[model samples]
Target: MSAPRLRVAPSPTGDPHVGTAYMSLFNLGFVRRHGGAFVLRIEDTDRARFRADSEQQIYDTLRWLGLTWDEGPDVGGPYAPYRQSERLATYRPFVDRLLADGHAYHCWCSPERLAQMRERQRADKQPTGYDRLCLGKSEAERRALGGFADTPVVRMLIPDDVPLTFTDVIRGEVSAPRPDDQVILKADGFPTYHLAVVVDDHLMQITHVVRGEEWISSTPKHLLLYRWLGLPAPAFAHMPLLRNADKSKISKRKNPAARLTWFVEQGYLPEALLNFLGLLGYSQPDGSEIFDFAQFSADFEWSRVNTVGPVFDLDKLDWLNGHYIRELDLAEFAGRLTAFAGDPAHADVIAAAAPLVQERVATLREGLDMIGFLLVDEASFAVDEAAAAKHLGEAGQEVIAAAVLALQADGEWAHEAIEAALRGALVDGLGLKPRQAFGPVR
Candidate 1:
């Protein structure tokens, strides 16, 4: 069998979503397992909500997470013009073919008329969908009848026998409700997602469609388009959606973690973040919670995917991140800490303190926080008065004095030597507990 082709298409509407990485992880994992191509298509057709910088953010965040694609807007592939907005001309031919074949028709109903139609349908307790008012009507006839727009939008004419069930690679047989005559092309000359995705996936030779389960309802519409256009449908695998602690669908509007950039900004290791996402709807064969991407790709299987939506557990992520941080060698951890601190000048200070804090922090941000005082100048440093008052009584003063004297007598500059000297003076010599001796100094 030939290698499969898969793509992760994300709309450049806002912050790159964590869903984008989640989908990409599975898509790329399958591709890696079968030696196929993983493509990144930017679905930027939603012009009203599209941000000028969002496409770049998608690239930046995905790359930050180590989810690199073989073909994308930045990296040209066999399928050039990876963005939907750039391929406007390519969709017109398919739309025209659908129209010519009696599979789709143009609707002149304006937004006001469609809204009124939906309002009437809701008032009468009917299934809300286009009423097919413009079907079989000429442009002039529709204009004469009443509400009509100058520009016409294309819609699919759903056949009575439209299949409502399809096989999902992950969920076995899945069924969706009968679809309405969905708009294939808007008056703005942009194709809707239903039309654009079908055309692009077919043309790009994508063999697998991996996305969130929320799209299950829309699968029938896409399958209809594929059948109507005489295009071979790809294997579909709808991954479970990520849910919040309350089991609500995770969204950028309500949850900051839904945004992919949040993980990067929080100083999470990309490997750890990637692994965390992998564990969301999948489990390793060895039943281990912690594993790298290479191991994940090697063991990728659609059958292993859990259909139930996984709750986004941040505490688990923190534990995994801490494990990864501790696994890093001191030199690499120090470098990462300096970079994440966003201050190149603090490299030496962070390096000097890396060993002391490497095992102490779960994230680079926390590591930096632990040594933040050392980064500031002498004048800028201020001890917490409450903390000092609590720990610096007479006994604390004695411990400090003994530590100073012992260090001054034979203090070695090395870590072990300094620790041994301080412990010997404060813990062994002064008969004070280790925490008692170190609490005030720290």
Candidate 2:
């Protein structure tokens, strides 16, 4: 078999989503392992939802996560015009061909009509979709309806009630009931996902279609389009959807974790976030969870991928990020902390205090809190209310006083001197236990 060619087509709708990163991880793994090409296509045909700058955000975030595509709108390839919006003219001839061959027909039904049709279908307990009202209308009937000024949307025909079966790389053989004829082209002259993806995948020779499980029901429609167009369909692998702790769909509106930029902004290392995503649906041969991306690509297997959805467990990710943080050399770690801090004023103090909390912080952003006590102005530094309430009683105050006297008399202003003074004053001098002695200071 030829090397698998995979593509991730993200709609330029909003801030790049973590789901986009998830799908891209799997797609990148497959293509990289097989020495194949990974393509990036922009599905911007949804004009109302499209943001002009969103496409760049998608590219930027994915690259930040180290998920690179060989060919994309930013980089031209054998299949030029990678963006669906740019390929508008390309879809017209295909739509015309489908129409001439009786594989699709024009539907002049307005939004109101379709809504009413779906409402009536719901009322009658029937499938909700286009009623194919324009299928066999005579010229006079169409003229009476609105003449050509209506600019009807094009709907592809679903031949018969046959089961559409496809072997999924991750889910094994899957079959779904053939769906109703779907709109291939909108009245605005833009092709729907079903039509655009089919054409682009076929033309780009995408050997594998790696996407979210939400698209499973729609796969049969895509399969039908490929059949009608006489184009070979790519292998399908629907990765399990990422869900919140409550088992609900992860949404940007409801969950900040759904936004990929949030992770980056939160100071999550790209490698660590990618590693977290890698383990969500796929795991290593040894069942380890901390491998880097290169190691992951080396051992990626479709058979090992899980069908059951994985939770976007932030705690687990924190633990993983901490592991990566500790693994970094001190210099690199300090450099990373500096970049994440994004404040020049804190640079020197952070550098000096880096080693103190290098072993404590999970994310670089957490460095601010871990070392804030050192760099924050004494006037502005307030004891955490919760900690103070728990530890700032009479005994805690005595412990603090004893440590201060010890440090005041100590001639050397060095690490060991400070440590010994603190221990002598608190741990050895005070009857309190180590945690008790340090509670107030901590």
Who wins the lDDT comparison?
1
**Candidate 1 TM-score, true structure as reference:** 0.89
Candidate 1 structure quality by residue, lDDT tens digits, 1-442: 5899999999999999999999999999999999999999999899999999999999999998888999999999999899999999999999999999999999999899999999999999999999999999999989997878999999999999988999999999999988999999999999999999999999999999999998999999999889888889999999999999999999999999999989888889999999999999899999999888899999889999999999999999999999999999889999999999998998998899999888888888888888998998998888889988988988789888988887887555887898899998888998888889899888
Range of the 10 consecutive residues with the lowest summed lDDT in candidate 2 = 140-149
Instruction: Quote the RMSD, in angstroms, for model 1.
Output: 3.4
In model 1, what lDDT does residue 338 have?
93
Q: Tell me the whole-model lDDT of each prediction, alpha carbons only.
A: 0.93, 0.86
Report the C-alpha displacement of residue 377, candidate 1, in angstroms. Answer: 2.3
- As for candidate 2, its clashing pairs are none
